[model samples]
Target: MILAAGQPDAPLLELFLAATAGNVLGAVVNFVLGRFLLRFEHNRWFPVSPANRQRAEALFNRYGRLVLLFSWLPVIGDPLTLAAGLLRTPLPVFLLYVTIGKAARYAVLLWAYTTLAG
Candidate 1:
């Protein structure tokens, strides 16, 4: 979608807005899921083990919400957003960082595409 949006005739601003909005929205979903999932922490069917959860929480505490800046990374991005929610990161803080990261990612990609294609 992003690559296609970078085509020469594409409406850059509109495409950028759409891409960023969708990406940030997806992250929000992950954040919400993380928050919701925590309610099942003690349930037998909970996926994450308690020890693993504790270790993740410790790491999140060490790094803090700044990790949300990397929320555009592929494999780790989704998990990072999710972790933010699991750790009870403030929604406003999460949105600010996540939006910046996601928007920057698309902007960079578009810039690179336009530069190379030209």
Candidate 2:
């Protein structure tokens, strides 16, 4: 869609910028949905238990803010953010690290995509 919307031979830099923005917005949406899961009385998808959440919290506690840095890793990122919400990690702290981590991931992805295309 993006490519079709732009010039046929659009520059790589433009694509990188556009993709990075999209990725950041996607990360924000992911975080919002993760937080919303907690507000629900019953989440059918992966019923999160307090005990399991406690264990996750303990891991986060040991890791501290570093947990956010690793929050963009595959298989681990999603659960880590969900765990953050369940553990009531401070909103500001969560946002800061998550944004950084996700942005870094996006940057790496965009760079690789562009490099591989060349």
Candidate 3:
């Protein structure tokens, strides 16, 4: 999008490749960061307080497994994964949800790039 926006008739292949590469890497980083760096029980980064965790836990206990469909949303998505991990939301299910969410998010990003940037 940057190139296309800058210079008309920019190479589509290169832009697509670059966008895909970054999105894939970003998803990996999101998963890894959730698994390793962040803390759900005690969020050091933001306002994912224990009270909030409890509320999120209650939600997770109920509809969490499904929210994975929206796992790519800003703010809540990344921390949701971390909370899922800390709460021991079965690893298999968590991975499944996260992947689904990430895929959807990437799809939207790709479409946006193709439409506006391509």
Instruction: Compute the lDDT of residue 71 as modeled in candidate 3.
Output: 57
* Rank list by TM-score: 1, 2, 3
lDDT of 3: 0.62
Expressed as tens digits, the lDDT of each residue in 67-110 for candidate 3 is 76565678876666666655556666766666666666656766
lDDT of each: 0.90, 0.68, 0.62
lDDT of 2 by residue, 13-103 (tens): 6666566566556555666776777776356565777677667768779879668777768887776776676667777887788777876
Q: For this target, which candidate reaches the highest lDDT against the unseen true structure?
A: 1
Clashes of each: 0, 0, 0
lDDT of 1 by residue, 36-90 (tens): 9999999999989999999999998898778899999989999999888887889
TM-score, cand. 1: 0.88
How far in Å is the alpha carbon of 82 misplaced in model 2?
1.0
Q: What is the TM-score of each candidate against the true structure?
A: 0.88, 0.64, 0.53
Q: Candidate 3, 108: how far from true, in Å? A: 1.8
Q: For model 1, which pairs clash?
A: none
In terms of TM-score, how similar is model 3 to the real structure? 0.53
